[model samples]
Target: MDHVQHLIDLLRDDLTAGRYRVDLVDGLWGDAAAAALFRGQTEPAVRALDAGRASGTPSTPVESFARLFLLGQALPIGEVAAAFPRLRVAGAEELGLVVPAGGDAGRMRAALDLRPYSFVDTLGAGSWWVVSDLGEAVLGRALDKDHVLGIGGASTTLSGLMIPTPVDSVLDLGTGCGIQAMHASRHARRVVATDISQRALDIARLNARLNGIESIEFRHGSLFEPVAGERFDRIVSNPPFVITPRVDGVPLYEYRDGGLVGDALVERVVREAADHLTPGGIAQLLGNWEYRAAPPGSEEGGSDGLERVRSWVESGGAELDAWVVERERQDAPSYAETWIRDGGTRPGTPEFAALYGAWLDDFDARGVREVGFGYVLLRRPAEGARATASAAPTPAMARYERVAEAVGSNPAGLGAHLEACLAGHDWQAHRDDDALLASTLVYASDVTEERHYWPGHDDPVVMTLRQGGGFARTAPLDTALAAFVGACDGDLSVRALCAALAEVLGVDESLLVADLLPAVRALVSDAFLLPAG
Candidate 1:
């Protein structure tokens, strides 16, 4: 641990001394190459030792002690060694900086400038600070230092889609570096973050302070152990769902390994989520699941390669409204390699190959054909059915839209869209308007189709098209609705225009009045469209 800390400190010192420039274009080098490259230059003491031994001259104690330091930093990783090619070469340089094949001088220069390169570089001096502080608490002791983490893409994705209603209590299961707990603290009056790793708990606490967040309780326990009987209005987790073999004496990566067998971690987490949620509460999580491969043409019945996750909101019979998105999928070897690199393992090394084999063996033993990763959002409404448990879970009440273009850099745009979606209604068009260009009104659709149901018998329901049904494919609209759509030309209330339409139609005013009024109201609430009002 001290060796690792010393190595990080040396790297920081090198940056300060102009020994290397942080390049944004190039990301963090892997462990193997980094180790080999830094092997000589970063260890001046080792260099002085060899020089002194060859010259038969005694070296200074400062030089004598550098060997231990170098030994500490020697990670048995090929990637770290490979990373050395990217290091800023000082004197006589052979392979000065490694550039991709066919890369130009610009690529070489970019590799030399390590500033803007990796995610850690974006953190700047903050990264050094975080590493140092974390090192003091976790690595400095005989505890796990391999696990270093913070909010990245996965954290923010889960945070954004989580139902954000204020809640009395929140729990962040498998808190790791506590990014989720930090977000939960903003809305949850009480927030508790739990992790099996004590080192992770220390860093999580440090992060809470660094971000100026208070009132969060950080506990060292696996899963629900920290708060056994306490139910939360909201619970969220970005658990370690990576399925790895239970190797004896092997250090855990703390960030991604939950130590559960195969899909057990994810399954147990989801299955028990309802137990921890308060009535009318919600739980959102990000996890990985296994999907088995199926044979072809035999009814096409194989496991869909999907990483499925659900919120498991506590409700009676019809207990929850769950939403899941299958974000990405990977086969056994790909998944194994992805995680190994993520854990700082060097590719092609003995240890790396061994770890890779173990991961695959674990997968094969469990019959996991593919791994899926995705998000889950579950809500337990205050009033919902307690349907009988079935063999399989029912499909969720969900809608999908490709709104990537609409999601601006600003969060407000995304938040507003969600709010409007919850209302489930479109806007109402007045009856007297005809020219849409005349008004400042804008409209959105609650659903793709707008239904104009006739009262009394449910047999003949007229459907009106709001926009964009080209080529002689016209939808039916009653006179009153046509007037409402035309009046949407920019002015007039639904009531005011409906009254005028009633007078004009004059068949039986009460009939249209009773039938169409509720439908008109449904539009506004649904946010199918929004008027200036």
Candidate 2:
């Protein structure tokens, strides 16, 4: 522990003094090299680093650190020593971050992946030095079963989706390198991060200390075992939800595969999360579901993937509000190919072929035709908010849809937008038609209307209300609805607007009010229209 603390202090000082960061490293290599690095091709970045060295120009500590760690290249012991001056090569060896190169006492190579990760959140921008097990690119072979992963695309996605609303406590289940937990610590008063792998916990602990963040409590267990009988105000997980076949000789990656058959791990997480959340608490996660073809003699062919997720929520023993979005879908073969390639198996190779076959056989046994990947948000109702068993009452809020479209320019952040959308849903839920008609609304600034008309016609044949941000939703509008939306400046009540539109269109006011009420409610729920004073 003493040695680890010393190493952490040295690393913090080195990174701070050297100014090792994303922008500086990118500027050092130029755009093309940075793009190549992003695509997992390190040759361009290596060449650029070598060029800087060969020019006989003195290298900055930032450049030396990037080459030795970020690029996974060896450097002379003397150069590393100069970059670290404080920790020195001896201290680095003690930290197990580097080892002497073969037959050369003057050179050293990294034993782990240490890189600078930067991001912007509700708190503003910050960077941290994250350490994890070396990846396939650095190892030049398949990863060990217990390998821990550093920040990746999935990590960023889940982090970005995390709602930034202040909370008392948060649970980061399946915390890998502690990325999610660290993000949660920014808003929550306390955070608990758990992982099934001890190695992951070790690295995550190292990361928390390295960043000077101490509010996160690390626990060792799978899923919710560590937090049994406890509840949190918010829960975030990017679990090992990869659907891997349970067969011989198929390597199960600790970072991705949870050793479950066909998306069961994700289902289990969904079902169990209810017990660990406070009333009105939110659980956000990313998952993949199998869309099986309907069984023989069934009214519908295989089960719908999104509906399966809905069933999981319903079986949770709690009346949970669910908002599920299926962002992308892939057929069986394509899904198999993608995951197989992800495991460091190259296509057109014997090993790849065998693993691909295993995936297909597994899918065939399950009758799976396609796989859908998406984000899920589940919220437990507040006290007395749940429906009673005596009545077959409708859920106040439940949305399950396929929003595969791109989100527009989201300057305010997606997490904030989603939180607001949920609040909007709840606000509209308790209002009946009469109450809705009595309300006034203002159009969201991000929303605009588009019209297409015949060549010379003044009136548009088609009218669409499009949101510039927040899911980039667009709703087709009819003549009366379009006019009503245009007049929603919060100055006129919904009832007044309907009355005026009816008079202008030469129609009965009562009928017009009835026709536009449902659409008005939908608009309000979706944030296209907002409640006004």
Candidate 3:
């Protein structure tokens, strides 16, 4: 362990001195290589790197490091030694990061994938070197069952969605590679990261040590098994929610497929999360839900994907608030093709065809017409607000919607925006319509309006209220509502704005207020409007 720590310190120093960063590496390889790398094709990147080396100039330390680890290319032992003068080849071998290639001491290959990851959050910009199992690009075949994943699209997505608010303790369920747990360590006093795979736990622990982060505690168990009877102020997970058929010859990749038929794994997480959250605590996760089709001539339709998630939360009996956003939906065939290809199976082959058939058969057996993939946010209510007589009147806020459109991008990420939106919801939840009307409100700074008029007409045909951030919501606006929103400059109360608009439109003030109150509440809840001082 001391040797490991010494090697990690040397590695960190070498990586920092070499300026091994995401942007610099991208610049060195150019856009084509970067794009090809994203598509899981390394030929372009390899060619670019080789060309740079063939330019008759010595490769820089950063370039050598990227070629070996980022692109999974073998490097000469001399070059590896130069890249890490402090650790050298012997130290890298001691760290299990590289090994002799074909019993040749002159050449070495990376045993694991280690690359620099940089990001900007509310706390500011920083980077870390993450190490994980070599992927298909390096292995040149399907991943092993216990393969651990490095930074990927889903990992970054969940990280960006995490609320960065300070907290006492956080639970990172299914903390593969410890990416989310490491991020949580930045804000929480302590973080408990649990995973069923010991291999994953080991790699995650190494990552924490490599980055000099000591606030995360690693545990091994599936789902809530490890953290039983324990609660956290915040929880985040990107679980193995992929739907796969339970049949022979179908490999259950422990990194993804959770050995569950359909989307039961995600449902189980939602159902069990309430038991592990403190009052007013929150759990954010990524999941997949099955959207089944209605049977022939049946009056009652099949289960809705979003509603199924709602049912899981309801069954928890915790009166938790849930906000589920189905980011995208894919049909049965498309979904099968995606996960099948993801497992390194190529099209136009017998093996691919067999897996595709298995997926279709499984979906058909369960009457699954489509699969909806999305983000879910669940919150346990505060103390004294449990499902008792005193709290019986306030309905558990459950928002389930399909937001397939692009949300506004935030440079600091969306976590802060989500935190504010939740606060807005809670603020409006306690106020009656009359109370809300009596309160003054201001349009959020990120909001703008657009109007489309007919070619030769004075009246506009279309109006939209657009939000620049926080899910980038756009709502259709009528003439009266548009005028009312325009007048909300923090100088007038909601009631005064409605009354003035009603007078201008020659409508009854009471009727107009009744008509606009619901929309007003929605706008406020979504952060398009805020309460004025």
Candidate 4:
């Protein structure tokens, strides 16, 4: 224990002194090369690295580490020692980070993928060293069923969506590599991270300790089994929610596939999250919901995946507030192919064909037409909400929508936007129409109005209101509503703006206010406009 602890300290010092950072790496290899590497092609980056070195030997610390770690290339022990003088080659071997090359006893190769990850979130800029299993590129074969994955696109998505509000405790349900738990620790006083796979728990613990974050506590068990009776102030998870077929010859990778058929894993997480949260606590997660056909001769018709998620919240309890955004949907073939390739299975192979057939057969048996992938943010209603100005507060939010816009990187993520929107929802939900009319609103800074005209006409034939953040939503607007939105400069109350528009359009003031009030409330809920400061 002491040896590993001492080695961890030495490793941290070496990483810091070597300037191992995402941006620094970009500077080293250029953006084009870095992007090519992300797409599973390392040639461009390898070319750049080869050009920088003389006689195939790394000349710098970051370059040496990148060659041995990220590029999965063997380096001489002398180069490894020079790269990390504090934690030399022997220390790295003792820490199980590197092993002597089989072909050449004098060379060392990375036993793990240790790289610097940098992000700018709700809590400013931060960087950390993440350690996880080597990828298929390094392993040169399909991943083992229990292989622990490193950072990927899903990791980036969940980390960006984490709310950075201060809380007493957070429960990270499936702490794969402990990424979300580390992100949670930035805001929470303490965090409990749980995973079903012991290997995953081991990697997560090493990752948390490597980053010098002490607030995270690691536990081993499946789903909520690790922390059943306790409640937390916040919960975040990127669970093994992938829908995989339960059949012979199908690989069940612990990192992606839960031991369930179809999308039941995500359903279980959504249904049980509220029971594990305190009052007003929020749960943020990514999920896949299936669009299944209704049975023959049934009164209820088939529904989209978003509606299915809505049913999960309703069945769970009334105290839960849910905002589900379906970002993408895929048909059976596309979804099957995606996950198949993810496990390093190449196309036109027998194994790929067998797995793909199994997936389609499973979907067919379940009557699933398509699958939806998106974010699910749920909140437990606080009892104090009724004590505010209104005699009866509105029920918890159960809104669902589909968002398809390309994400913007302004604040790097939507946590701040989500936080603001929740606050805006609470502010407007307690107010009746009259109260809402008296309140002032201003369009968010990222908002813009788009006008389309017909061949140089005097007026626009079509109009739209677009938001640059918080799901990157865009709404079609008629002339009157566009005028109302344009007039929202935080100067006058909604009542005054509606009345003025009504007078100019020669319509009934009451009718205009009635028509505009619903749109106003929706805008507030979706965060197109905000309550005046």
Backbone clashes in candidate 2 total 3
- Angstrom error at residue 371, model 3: 1.0
User: Model 1 over residues 159-228: C-alpha lDDT tens digits?
Assistant: 5655556778999998877767776776678899998888678667655654457779998888988888
Q: Write the per-residue lDDT of candidate 2 for residues 228-248, one digit (tens) a residue.
A: 999999999999988888999
Indicate whether candidate 2 or candidate 3 has the larger lDDT.
3
Best-performing candidate as measured by lDDT? 3
Better of 1 and 4 by lDDT: 4
The clash number for model 1 is 55
> Which portions of model 3 miss their true places by more than 4 Å?
294-300, 384-392
* lDDT tens readout by residue for model 4, 1-533: 67777888899999989988887777778989988888877778888888877556537788887888888999889889998899988899988889999989999999999989988887689989999998887777898899888999888899888887899999998888889999999999999999999988888888887889999999999999999899999999999989999998899999999999888899999999988999899999999999988877788887779988998998986568888988899998899999999999998999999999999999888888899999999998886774446576567787798877577556669888888889888888889998999989999999988888899698888889888777777888987899988889999999999989999999999988888888888898878989997
Model 1 gets an lDDT of: 0.52
CA RMSD of all predictions: 14.4, 2.3, 2.1, 2.0
Error of 2 at 371 (Å): 1.0
Model with the higher TM-score, candidate 1 or 4:
4
| Every candidate's lDDT | 0.52, 0.87, 0.89, 0.88
In model 2, what lDDT does residue 101 have? 76
lDDT of 4 at 387: 48
